[model samples]
Target: MAWGRIQTADGRTLSGMLTDTGLQPMTGFGSTTPAGPVEALDGATLLAPCQPGKFIGLWNNYHAAAEKNGLAIPAAPLWFLKPDTSVVGHGATVTLPPQAGRVIFEGELGVVIGTPCRNASLAEAEAAIFGYTCINDLTSLDILNADPAFAQWSRAKGFDGFGVIGPSIATGLDWRDLTIRTLVNGRERQSYPASDMIFSPAEIVQHLSQDMTLMPGDVIAVGTSLGVRPVKAGDVVAVEIDGIGSAEVTLA
Candidate 1:
């Protein structure tokens, strides 16, 4: 089943299970049964699939990107946090901040946690996963490397509306068979297979759980492959995963 949030015609925000024709309002978070009438998705506004408390994006997690960038493979995942305020759902218009130089879009697969866990084992981590979604981890490249002493990972990527995810959270998604793609203004810019990841989704969760408590809706972006370029003010950037869906944002 696919889950998503939306703003109804009445201006109320609700969570629901998404069907091809419409949305069935969920009983509550994580529930499978419907509690209200089916809603016509076209008349409602879609939101980020879930309200994530933390957004962690990985780096060097893809073998293809690692090799292309001439970076050595690391034993553990390298990640950075994007503030919750930066997150936006599909169809959002993202404003480019002043002095935010050369922003690029990263198309990735996102793992959404379903259960709270700390130091979870592989099996536990696998079980804790709720669903998967696509993520667009936009970064301000020039600002990231500008400082000599420290890398501005957060600032470079944590600008408002930079952490884009969701059209819906797809349950039972097979990472091995998935493909991620990014488009800028309707033209495909990046495309890669999910099979290229050095760390599987479950392994990433297990490792991350060892360091911090992961709660339901917390997102771990599995990282991106090559083919990233700067996005301009008028561009419409979109990240799409074969099994999940697209998270699109218009830059302004």
Candidate 2:
């Protein structure tokens, strides 16, 4: 099953269907059966799939990309956090805020938390998962790697619309065997298999739970591989993971 949050023509927001066919309202994101009203897709627009309390992301998780950047494979998973407001929905335009310089696009696999968990073991972590989705973790690289006095990831990556997720969340996709890709202007800039991940999704969750509580709706971006590239205004950025679907956004 797929889950999404959409906007209605009347400006009302609610969770619903997210497919090429269009939006369909349901009781909630956790609704099991798809027996809901066939509200006009135009009645609502898509919103970021979930309103997460914590948005955790990973770095150096992909082996190929780490090697390309002349970096060693991490001894352990490196994780970071982006502000909740960074999220935007599919088909939304990402405004390159004036303060940002040298913005880049990172296509990644996103894991959505289904239940609350803390200090979970690998076995327990496996049960905490809810689903998966696509992530376009747009970054302001200059600001991200700036001076030692001001190198704060929260400011560099927390800009509104900097984190783009959706089309929809796949509830039962096998994450270990997916192709993650990023395309800019019809050109394939990045492509790697999920097998390239240095750490498994369950490991990421288990590690994260040691330090923070994983709550329902919290997202863990599995990190990107070597295909990260710069983008400018008017360019279209797309991230697709086979079986999960694609998420496209325009730079504005």
Against the true structure, whose lDDT is highest? 1
Maximum-TM-score candidate? 1
Per-residue error for 101 in candidate 2, Å, reads 0.9
lDDT of 1: 0.90
| lDDT per residue (tens digit) for residues 11-108 in model 1 | 98888898886888988767877788988887888999888998999999999889989999989999899999998999999999988979999999
Q: After aligning candidate 1 to the native by TM-score, how far in Å is the CA of 10 from where it should be?
A: 2.1
Runs with alpha carbons beyond 4 Å of true place in candidate 1: none
Task: Quantify all predictions' global Cα lDDT against the true fold.
Answer: 0.90, 0.85
Estimate the TM-score of every prediction.
Answer: 0.96, 0.93
**Residue 140 in model 2: lDDT:** 90
Q: How many residue pairs clash per model?
A: 0, 5
Query: Which tens-of-lDDT digit does each residue in 63-129 have in candidate 2?
Result: 8888888889887788889999899988898899988899999999999998898999999898888
Write down the RMSD of all candidates, one decimal each: 1.2, 1.9
Kindly report which residue stretches of model 2 are placed more than 4 angstroms away from their true locations once superposed. Answer: 17-26, 33-36
Clashing pairs in 1: none
